[model samples]
Target: MNSPGVKIHHLDGIKILDLFAGPGGLDVAAHFLGFKSIGIEWDRNACETRYAAGLPTIHADVSVMRESRFAEIPSTVDVLAGGPPCQSFSVAGNGKGRRALETVKKFIHRLVDGEDEARIDEDLRALDDPRTALVLEPLRWLLKAIDTEGRDPYKVIVLEQVPAALPLWEVYAKLLRGGEGRLKGVKYEAECWQLKTEQFGVPQTRTRAVLVARRPGHGAIAPLKATHFPFDLHRGKRNVAQAEMFPAEPATPGGKQRWLSMAEALESASSLENSPVDVSRLRRNGRMEFFVVSNYGSGGDPKNRGQRLSSEPAFTVTGKVSRNKVYKSMAEYEADTSERFTIHESGVLQTFPHNFPWSGNDQAQQVGNAVPPRLGMHVLSWALRGSPPSDDELVAAATWPNTPRTTTAELRDIGCGDQSQCPPGSHKVTRSRRKPAP
Candidate 1:
């Protein structure tokens, strides 16, 4: 792909504040897009990761922080972006969703109140236990506060969440547009878009709902266009030569289809490292026994490696990956043991460049929960570019860097500290030692 002339400083000196800045995914993208950014996150580990990446961050609960405190932030932040926690809205969380919505509402109220301690506290108490409505509520208040101060500090507010939050978009839309919500005077119109991560160059097929709002007077900016190929065999436009697909049109106004495959998302690169398992040990372990002699593809032999599907994008990454199971074809599985997606690999899939360090589990839940950094980068690019690029322009943009291949032996020998630790039974091999000279 050729580099486009679009510059990162689309807004030229705009400032951004990211809430719920998990591991700096959005913040890193924002910086690359040329916005001066400050991230607010409550998780210590996430904060550390952000800090280590050299991104400025504020560690605090959005619920407790007063709106006046936001004044402590720049008076003219050009953009406010974040994805509030969506557990309450999730099907697993059930009816508690209302309470969660309320928590978001309260948080918006406080932000609008300019951090009035009394009001903030009252809003907090108003929320029922096991509820988190305070989260979205304060942002409502913050938006209004920004407007009332006569500084159109935030040109855009991007709210990203799981599909369950679709219903709440109208609620936020109303609140921002100065309708039936407590946040008055913050008149804005919102455009909602849903995207599968693969559509944005992420290997995983994770889908997220995004709401983009701008103050009423600003000329309308269309919803962001998808940049990655869709998983569907039939739908949208197809690139016959590249063999890329686009997402199908939404079945309903707000619904979308499944994700993409791994091979389709990544470009081919030489294998840099290998971490072969002890076949005997794997056979002994019931969990991995099947993999010992499993066929990965048309390449039937257990000894010969299989190949990854280069034409398709990857499956959604998760934290609960089983040692023996495979997401792609068996032939693809035999190609490389490390090819079974790891957390680091998943991170890369999310568009987090190699430089961003992640700490914690190497499992499915963690991987699945992460926002694809590439998607984040794309959003940041939109915010920075001020205008959306044409479909042709977006397609012409650069894909992420390829993963450098290396052998586990080479990695360990070079002392690359962040290298994936060897799995069970693969003790570090050492040359025989000579008898000590007497």
Candidate 2:
């Protein structure tokens, strides 16, 4: 039987309020599908980048401007989307997730225990920075909006972060939907899951924890499927149902889905391997390395050596440039990628528009921090009432710096201050006291 061909639909004028929108990656997807969105951002450079990209933005921190600031938008809004900054919770950065988790847990406990909301407010007000806790701002807005409207305030809420934030997101789902049994006063139904970007047609192996909540009568939140199946990455398009029948790998998606490998994406740069290689002189901040010298810097552990194979999706793009080093293996000449990925290449991997007119002072940071418009498209497409976009539409949204579910409170805290519990091969390596230049 032939799978019904996908017919892309117009966005139907759904509006979105994007929080912590960095460089407009999510907004890019919204635009591709013809949706209106207003992004809230505090970073001046990132705001400049968003404006140059033609995305509307409010230049203010979520804490400062607040969601109420945008409640007056002329258009009716249906979705709220954003991925809070991950530095405070990322293993690559100083591990403040533990401290922030405690405070947030206490705050949630108090709120559910019938404590005065004002007193809890005063306690959180005294918090020191509480950067990791910034992720909670979205939930705060969700509650405020639903109560203020006395109905489903928004059709959907989408949030993404590093794996560490999974627990916090689960906690949020519990508080909002009352977890197992829908509480008497809960506002919506919610679910969370972990999604690998490569499976979703992104040419990268970045994994994120995503949570989706919707008011009753809307679809339930479930793990978004990969448009580009893994087996498809190895071969051309095939029947997706067949793949589903023969579960090859442990977590393989059943379908004709094939991943878009790095080679396919960087075909433009295929001939550039002969150019001069820019190898790092010192080794530090990397979680792994190749068999070269100990000083040769890279990001993963000994097994992967941080080499991003052209045959596979790229490693997770990070603010740290040293994480994903390109490894070119030619018939005669094999070495680390000679030149660094151009700003455009990085944008492509992040699934941004080709050479998106970058206006920010920190080009790398802007690119790395985005959610990839392609990835955002899949999310926004499904988020709309009835999940209207066709499968083809969802797949089209995943070409580059593109960008999913719910897991339990499986986040580790004991060794979280270090990378001890990060994914295999992503722990920090202490080298000579000297630091390396980016």
For residues 1-438, write the lDDT of model 1, one tens digit per residue: 111221222212437777776776676566555567766666545644554455555556554333434544555476778877756665434546654664555465455546865666675665554445534543653545555655564667777877767656655665666633335454667767677777665665567777777766656657676644465543233344123343434455544433444432332111212311122222222322222122323255655532223344544443333232433335544565433444544455565553244543333344455566667766666645655434453332222222223322222222112323222222344689999999
**C-alpha lDDT of all candidate models, in order:** 0.51, 0.60
Local error of candidate 1 at residue 296 (angstroms): 22
TM, every model: 0.61, 0.68
Candidate maximizing lDDT:
2
lDDT of 2: 0.60
Determine which window of 10 residues in candidate 1 has minimal summed lDDT: 1-10
**Across residues 317-428, which tens digit of lDDT does each residue of candidate 2 receive?**
7654433444333311254443356666677777775546677578888888989677777777766644535656554443323120000001111111143322334333
- Where is model 2 poorest over a 10-residue stretch in terms of lDDT? 404-413
